[model samples]
Target chain A: MFSKESLDNLILSKRTVLCVGLDTDPAKIPAHITGTTKQKVMEFNTSIIKATHKYCVAYKINVAFYEALGMEGWQILFHTAEYIKSHYPQHFLIADAKRGDIGNTAERYAKAFYDEMPFDAITLSPYMGIDTVAPFIRRGKFAIVLALTSNTGASDFQLQPMDDGKPLYQKVIEKFSEKFGRDEIMFVTGATHSPMLKSVRSLVPDYYLLIPGVGAQGADYLTTLSNALNASGAGVLINSSREILYASSNDDFEEAAAAAASKYEF
Target chain B: MFSKESLDNLILSKRTVLCVGLDTDPAKIPAHITGTTKQKVMEFNTSIIKATHKYCVAYKINVAFYEALGMEGWQILFHTAEYIKSHYPQHFLIADAKRGDIGNTAERYAKAFYDEMPFDAITLSPYMGIDTVAPFIRRGKFAIVLALTSNTGASDFQLQPMDDGKPLYQKVIEKFSEKFGRDEIMFVTGATHSPMLKSVRSLVPDYYLLIPGVGAQGADYLTTLSNALNASGAGVLINSSREILYASSNDDFEEAAAAAASKYEF
Candidate 1:
């Protein structure tokens, strides 16, 4: 069970809140890793896991890269999650698949990630409302809802003012936090939105925020950490994907990933 | 290209706006035709497509059910889409995956569904903003954004009042339609929200709306059709999943599905 206590313990022990994103692309990986795309992804992830397990408390596998490879990609996804669970029992595993659907479909998705694969958490899109999110929150698994994303398109609707004067993203965080507590739910506040982090923190201070866009996306670590950190000084999982995963396109890729991860250590 | 003309031709030719949702669950399929879960799904989908092609103009395959079966399930998804393209070339195909992410990840997702697979349209969650959705909208493909879902949870966020006195869903429709025309983008408005359909139609009268929650979900067909129809008299694809897929749990499931689908024919 990936409760708040378990996450907090990991944060304390690891001395860092880095959640390494394994958004591995076959074309981006080192040419030395031979074989099918799935095999190469598996090898790359395994090496990275072996080398950088100590520096990070969580591993977020982006589902898009896997799905792009077809069936073999799904196999790699299952294998990756299973590998992490068996090898690094202490680490939190996240399926960074921003998925949500109607009630029944959502249940099947929950079963796929939470039951079938053993991810401790899965990123969810709250556009479909609470029912789409409810299925993913059971069995001590967390559903990290997209709140204030760091992307340019976030301004389209997320930052739009609601009738109550708060932004749509704020309303999403408030509603989700109210329905599901900090344990069952978390918010994805982009590192690019460092200024908005305080506003988000003010709404759900107790809930952990899974932040992306720190390393490669050019979000400042100190600003994000200072603004979004909670009362316990541990309420954010700062993710760095390409900056760590593709640190070097060479045989020393694993060592480079470890080094990149070490730099994010708090 | 799944252009307005292509859709209009199908609607006129078929004389119906029914989009049979292939939310095929391995467990829910008939007991007679059996094999591995993936094979059973493929068999079931193939039989249903053969049986219902004359009644419905489109097929909406929910990705969650296929993803639940892992690697082999993805093969079935590909097979199902391929079968439709080969056999029923005139019919529209939608990947009801409800996927979105940052720009890079979204690009991979677009490649998976639009480039790698032959889906005419793919559903998108708009929470991540435009960059996440923009990648999916390309030449001859459609990005159907979630406006207001049929679930009870729609009240949680979609129906919330924005500062302009319009609900968030209205804002979403307005923004997306402004950026992308009726040809490139569509909206998913639930059949249950019949009254709200008028408001939605007012926002984007010409654009197509994918209406689910009919049949098994107990949404009134006439009410939805009356309020949501466009100037062409064919502006909605009323999706019926369980109602058409599991019309009968017996050996004659395909026949029953065909019969159920015929009921929705104009």
Candidate 2:
């Protein structure tokens, strides 16, 4: 099993906590990596990894991207995960797949992502309750639960109060921490909701928070980073996808990606 | 587009609605079919397909099954979905993969399962509300919403009463049917709660309910079928996975599967 110290060591040595979201949408990827065909998804991803390898501490490949392409897409996803693990062992890899269900189902999921795939972490939605989130934590892999999101649809159910009077997101943080222990878990809070980050850190001060919404969704990095740091001075893993990948469509893709990401730090 | 008539005609012609779940465990499969270690999974799945192709109208392969194998498993999944569509076009295919989220995300998911993978139906959880499920209910494709699941854990949130006093599952059914126009969607209600089927049918008389908790789960078909039929007299697609798949692992595995499933008519 991977220890907390082990994961922390990787994060520290990696220097930047910036997670390059390898959300390589075929339609959006630069024309050069994939000149003119339905193929080259994996090649595009390979180039993205080769380019951004040094700039980021972790790589978060949203499963939906490859999954949308069917077999070839899955091939790209698998190869990408493997390539990341073998070449850059220090880089923390995450399957940005927000999966959640029950114990038996969750166990299968844990096997698929943790035991099977080479991802260091995975994103989870805790709407199904504790059983849904608990199995992943036990495997010693990071289970990033949705704390708050930047989407307009976030108001649908996430922020709504439960019978206990506390908002659902608050209850999730409390319950998940109590059951799973906070270290093996991380919460995904939107970079846009920087104001709430201070209160989130105050609630549980040591755990890492995966903050999305810093790039295309428009969350300010400076405000989110400052507000989300816990008392122990740890929180807010800023994930930037489109901004980093699409930083430049030219031949200097890798350098452009590194330059774009170098502008930010933990 | 998959029309209602086409679905009906196909089901009738096939004369079997047994949705064999290929929740294929790499450990449980025969030693040889999984291939010389690496492609063992693909081998196992191919063997199962060849063995159990008849006596079933649909095959629901849980994404978790292949996903647990990492990229290789995903590769196997891609080939498997492709194989089923090409070889057994008559049989309705299901990616027992439960997917539902926001507009753009759901659109990608729709493309993943419906367009790319091309599963006739894909299961989804309605936790995020109707907007989350709509992107999946395209013209001919079927979106199976989780109405009442077999797991005891489903009782935690799904069957729990809302502040409005009605069970959340009921509201989900009413809302989903109203939005998706009833014809394009199917609800997952287990045979375990055979008693509840009557009430569910009263609410959704014309729609189909994909029942999963039969056989080992102790859902008796005789008891459930009587209670499940609606005004038009047909409802409930009873699925018995372990009962059908692992029935006599010694020899004649496919024959055994066919024998067990022969009782059910579409």
What does chain B score (TM) in every candidate? 0.98, 0.91
- Give the Å error, residue B7, model 1: 0.8
DockQ of candidate 2 against the true complex: 0.40
Clashing pairs in 1: A162-B162, A162-B163, A163-B162, A163-B163
Model 2 TM-score, 2 decimals: 0.87
DockQ of 1: 0.82
Candidate 1 CAPRI category:
high
lDDT of 1 by residue, A126-239 (tens): 888888888887767899999988899999889989987888898898888888998899999988987899988888989999999898899898888899888988888999
Per residue, candidate 2 scores C-alpha lDDT tens digits across B34-149 of: 35443766665666677667766678887876777766776677788888888888677888877765566778778888877768888887655667777887776789988887
- Residue B210 of model 2, lDDT score: 88
Model 1 Cα RMSD, 1 decimal: 1.2
> Per-residue alpha-carbon lDDT of model 1 for B1-266, expressed as tens digits?
77987897789778899999998888888999888887788888999999999999999999999888765777888889999999998888999999999888998898888877889999999887877888887877899999999999889888988898888888888888888988899999998988889989988988999999888899988888889888888978999999889989999998999999998877
Question: Clashes per prediction?
Answer: 4, 6
Over 4 Å off, model 2: A1-16, A34-47, A50-55, A101-105, A192-199, B1-17, B30-54, B193-199
